[model samples]
Target: MVKRTAEQRVLLDQIKQIADGLGQTLAPFCEVVVHDLLEPEQSILAIHNNLSGRAVGDPTTELGQARITDPDYPQVLANYANQFADGRQAKSTSIGIKDASGNYIAALCMNVDLTLFRSLQMAMGQFVQTATDGPKETLDPAGTDALRDRIDAFAARLATTPRALKTEERRALLGELKASGLLDVRRAMETVAAHLGVSRAAVYSYVR
Candidate 1:
């Protein structure tokens, strides 16, 4: 049986509001799937898979080919460490989720959307071309789209504040992001850092 929590339902309603507030529809690719990594009871909370109207059993496969990991960004794996470090300051929007005891839960998150950032990527490309070569126009739309998605995911993971974690708390947080489902731990951490308005290097300090 698929059980939906009040939080899950609220999230769905929020997504709807997001669409209405934007004055544009969410890309069919937009979705929200919650995972309870701490459950005794490990289970997928909600898999709101709505892909461009095409049902592709796995949401990850259906979206544009965004790189799930970045070799240059190693600060990602340490993101889960922030869970115990006083999340109040954890600047990442994705880092805001908490468990029953008001502690942050370790989960594979899928709540954020990157439509707006997609626009920014395009603008940056255009800016580069006009500023560099006004006489010759050059911009790769496909590349820009791909980069935008990667940036969004990476940024989301990177944006967060530490939760003032203890030694044991740090260990547990690391365990969560490095879990099986949380692959490319570095990229994920960097994404969280980007969201938190911090440098990836600062996040890396937590892991060490």
Candidate 2:
């Protein structure tokens, strides 16, 4: 496993704090992971901080290979990092800080139970309702924080779309499987397909 940076340690503490304070507010059972860089081509991930456990079968995520390699790709992770650094948000609901080059500086994400949030939203009880409908948020705090602004904006775009996963995200998932010694490509595709509600073909399309 790779060691986190000095600044990243700060983010790690924040992750623990958030997990303690608002972890329940999250959907459920969904662990949040944070990374600094997405080296999809090389299957390398630079994790800054994460609350998601590395228990029996957990590996880091490296799901940005395809899009990261494409210069014209719409949702490249590097692009988001740059935009966030420039104080401009990207399209997805990514909750973290990234350098101009897409290296994660600081971030906070919660493992959420989609079903519960949906049910709670349907009930429309005391949950705070924004102009948007969902409750997922991205935060880039101070203290050695390297992530730029607009990360929240990128995360918002991610939240609005139903199937808007980026190459980095897919690559991240693949890395997780590989590191766990469970890199059965075919099985991985099937499992990811089931989780994303996409077809095995789509999973292969991104991962391959």
Candidate 2's error at 130, in angstroms?
29
- Residue lDDT tens for model 2, 1-208: 3466666556556655664555344324344444333322222122222223333123323333323344333332321221123343222223544435555444333333344445777888655556666776655223111111122233355573224556676565545545654444334445556545678787666656
lDDT of 1 by residue, 25-142 (tens): 3333344344333331433344454322322133332111121222122212222311212222111122123334443232333332344456788999888773545476545332
Measured by TM-score, how close is model 1 to the native structure? Answer: 0.24
The whole-model C-alpha lDDT of candidate 2 against the native structure comes to 0.42
- Runs in model 2 deviating more than 4 A are 1-4, 27-57, 62-93, 99-102, 105-107, 116-208
